[model samples]
Target: MKEVKAFAPATVANVACGFDILGFAVDSPGDEIEMKLVDKPGIVIKDITGDEGRLSRDPRDNTATVSVYQFLERIGAEKAGIEVVLHKKMPFGSGLGSSSASTVAGAFAVNALFDNPLTTEELLPFAMEGERVACGAAHADNVAPALYGGFVLVRSYDPLDVVRLNVPEELCCAVVHPHIEVSTKDARNILRGEIPLVDAVRQWGNVGGLIAGLEQENYDLIGRSLQDVIVEPIRSMLIPGFDEVKRAAIYAGSMGTAISGSGPSVFSLCRGMDKAERIAKAKVEAFKSIGIESDMFVSKVNKVGPKIIY
Candidate 1:
């Protein structure tokens, strides 16, 4: 194939209790990448859209371009000339796995052009490399779900192990992105390196319960288990009107709510679209009351991952 285009869905990382380990894909507000063979050697970024020129065009600095470059190098095709174009449908630094969507789209598209040399799992590391360039750390929570879809658990990073967890069909997600920028780097920096043993034990129990809830398809268990005593207490402070917004979501019938990825965006899980819509409106209104403009998305869990668009 001489050219290919693909779309990758946005992801919600952390998923409350399972920090750095759990995530799930959402339908809508993703990234698209198009790649075509070129006569010139090496990878070149031809164009970008919806990013307000905030993202770098240089291959070395851009996540999508860097991922495509790495894929070429892995296949011993570094000298193969290719041009890439990216369309960012989501806001950067909004904690919705914006960079991961782009990286996965680029890598997935380029791999399609080569008739698929790597499996979805195999494409993960390259995607994480792109994530590292953007966030200053190699994390699989966002990239894994964006690549594989549904709910994912990064059980172990030592051997790069990942598991696709079952998600109940009735479960829905509502997210609100406040008009504020919170860099992933800044969010990570604010986290304390160590937590008390008491908090650690509480966190461990909740994560285990969350996994069990997902496996058992028990919505109540999942909601009760979605407590985050470690990350949320600290990171929620960075988001304006976080407490009020979360309270509103819960009062509006959301199962549980937490900061999405690094923040400025918050997500809640609900049983159906009706509750999800109410939660979204409540969350948005709470932000507005605080003089913060926001955007809300209510969507079902995306079962399909990245796909070739053309």
Candidate 2:
């Protein structure tokens, strides 16, 4: 039996303007999974580690475990059973795309084990499937970038049109994962069903402008367009120091700052590593004052999505 290993990166979604359609990867943190096909006809999961006993091993409950099983079933495994192991290296509900990374690793591992019967592009739907089980909704904004890397402009879902933009440089960004959990379903429930037409128009304008800014590397324009009057204000109330942390990041010279996902985690884009570190520091201080412990990840924009570690 051939052993297949896969790794996937953590992601930050809701980059101010794109909301459900945008995300980027961060370096050093991710999830890994290994899989091998056996002669048995069923799928079995074993050897889970790294997560604080948070990830479920049941195929129906575990995002990574379900990914392998779904992919094998779709491709007709031909009497080959699956043995899977998950290394959930990222924290749950940290807005770091832990579940998405886990899903991506599992899907790619199974595909590679079967001698890569699917192309990378062909693999997205399977990854999407994995996320549906994980987050209730199949929002691929986080998963796509974690799986494929780089900034993505998800234009449509029916035909799945997304443009992978060239990253201008190894940009510095900071993630402050406050020691808190916001379930995906709760986050969704907090969102209002209706928005003013004027606000909708402005939101689309910002989304379009942000795309152009990224494409041209116009830092000023990008920062200006990173305004979210739609979702951030409503969700910010849930996080203890959201307002102060954002203000501190901007005052500390961050180009932009926003909630990472359905977050207690927040991210700041900065000029360099030093600025990123300072932003992380400011964020920690802001959270600590509110009685929340936080972990800071000083990372750059990760261009390489995922790679096998062994």
TM-score of each: 0.97, 0.94
The whole-model lDDT of each prediction reads 0.92, 0.83
Candidate 1 structure, TM-score to reference: 0.97
Write down the TM-score for model 2.
0.94
> Judged by lDDT, which candidate is best?
1
lDDT of 1 by residue, 85-169 (tens): 8999999889999999998998899899888999888889999999988888889999999999999999999988999999998
Model 2 clash pairs are none
